[model samples]
Target: MSIQDYPSRLSDPKSRKTETFSYLPSMTDEQIKAQVQYIINKGWNPAIEHSEPENAFSYYWYMWKLPMFGETNADTVLAEVQNCIKANPSNHVRLIGYDNFAQSQGANMLIKRGDM
Candidate 1:
């Protein structure tokens, strides 16, 4: 199919779309934890903040294995997330690697779980 007729792959709530990935791992454990806190502090679901210490490490790996979220600029966001996590240690949180899953899935989870 030509590019014009290739059809946009963007996901629609009415129609589930297949996710894509760039195979790039971003952020460290500290960074993931930090981002999780950031997300939680922003009024996201506390459950999303819940994760095992290992989750922090596997987060990047999960993102690497997932075929979705793009890698571009993800590191920057991860850094910001880490900063947030650092600022809120007592607030248990976990950063779900956006680069590892479909943005739609993330959004749906956030909404469904009332994390956002």
Candidate 2:
């Protein structure tokens, strides 16, 4: 089949990994909590976003209307994750941690619980 016929290959062995859980299985809530706590300890603020594009290569994304900063508690972070999940349950959702000191994202994680 031609590349245009298929948007993605589920079995691609060389899939690029850009974040902590990019390659392996998706993380549990506890794992996310611990990681977010770590980032908060470092004074980073977290943001959440979601999107449903025509293909995996699309660049379109929509940030949630809610604010992205000031919450450091793990439970709060996980709640936002759940909120993101609810908002875009069937598409791609991401949790990004921004370092105020560096003015750049330190953590970028995406999750999709079911087939696309």
Candidate 3:
């Protein structure tokens, strides 16, 4: 197949595309917990954000309250993720680990997919 033919296999343009992980199979809860643990171990602050499916690829996302600074408990971060999901059932929810030292995002992953 030619490179030009690749576009034909892609989903519709209007369809939702969250992030790199979206292309992979949906992650289980345990896997998500492990990721959260990894983020905490990296000394990154965890934050929850959500956006409409159409804006999934956009640079900005609505922050769920604020980032949990100095939060070491994985369960606490996971709970906030659930809260964001419940509040925005029709929007895509994501978890991001902000690196204060680097002043940028160190980790990002889609936790839930909204209705497309």
Candidate 4:
């Protein structure tokens, strides 16, 4: 159920905070880097998105910045990630791969640099 349907006494048990990547099996730097490389190989740009509505129930996230595909280097991936994390510390952030030829693919929760 949406956050609105749930009661305020407690959080929803089925509440799925992150997508694509789980907090339990956090992704490693290498894995994330490889994924970024793959996206770059696919000629896609990296982007970040997040929600802004109050009550913390809105799932409609907006693009923090425009899709940047010029720099296909792996460093760009990490740079975008750092930028996203620095931009949205408290709010939820997602890593999206944008492409013009094909549909966009996004991997949620890619900012965890602690452990895999």
Using all chains and alpha carbons, the TM-scores for the candidates as numbered come to 0.26, 0.72, 0.86, 0.65
The residue-level lDDT of candidate 3 at 95 comes to 91
lDDT of 2 by residue, 77-103 (tens): 778778778866775677778888888
Best candidate (score: lDDT): 3
For residues 1-116, could you state the per-residue lDDT of candidate 4 as single tens digits? 65444232324423443433543465677877887787778777777666531323456766777777565788866886677667766555556777766664633443443111
Query: How displaced is residue 46 in candidate 3, in Å?
Result: 0.2
lDDT of 1 by residue, 1-116 (tens): 65443343334322222222112233455654554555444443222233223232233221212222333344454454455455544332433433223333232111111111
Against the reference, the lDDT scores of all candidates come to 0.34, 0.67, 0.86, 0.59
Better of 1 and 3 by lDDT: 3
Candidates ranked, most accurate by lDDT first:
3, 2, 4, 1
lDDT of 3 by residue, 1-116 (tens): 65432232236744445567877788999999999999999999999989987777678899999899999999999989988888899988889999999999999999898887
Number of the candidate with higher TM-score, 2 or 3: 3
Residue ranges of candidate 3 with Cα displaced over 4 Å: 1-16
TM-score of 1: 0.26
Q: Pick the candidate with the highest TM-score.
A: 3
Model 3 alpha-carbon miss at residue 2, Å: 9.7
What is the number of backbone collisions in each predicted candidate, taken in the order shown? 10, 0, 0, 0
Ranking by TM-score: 3, 2, 4, 1
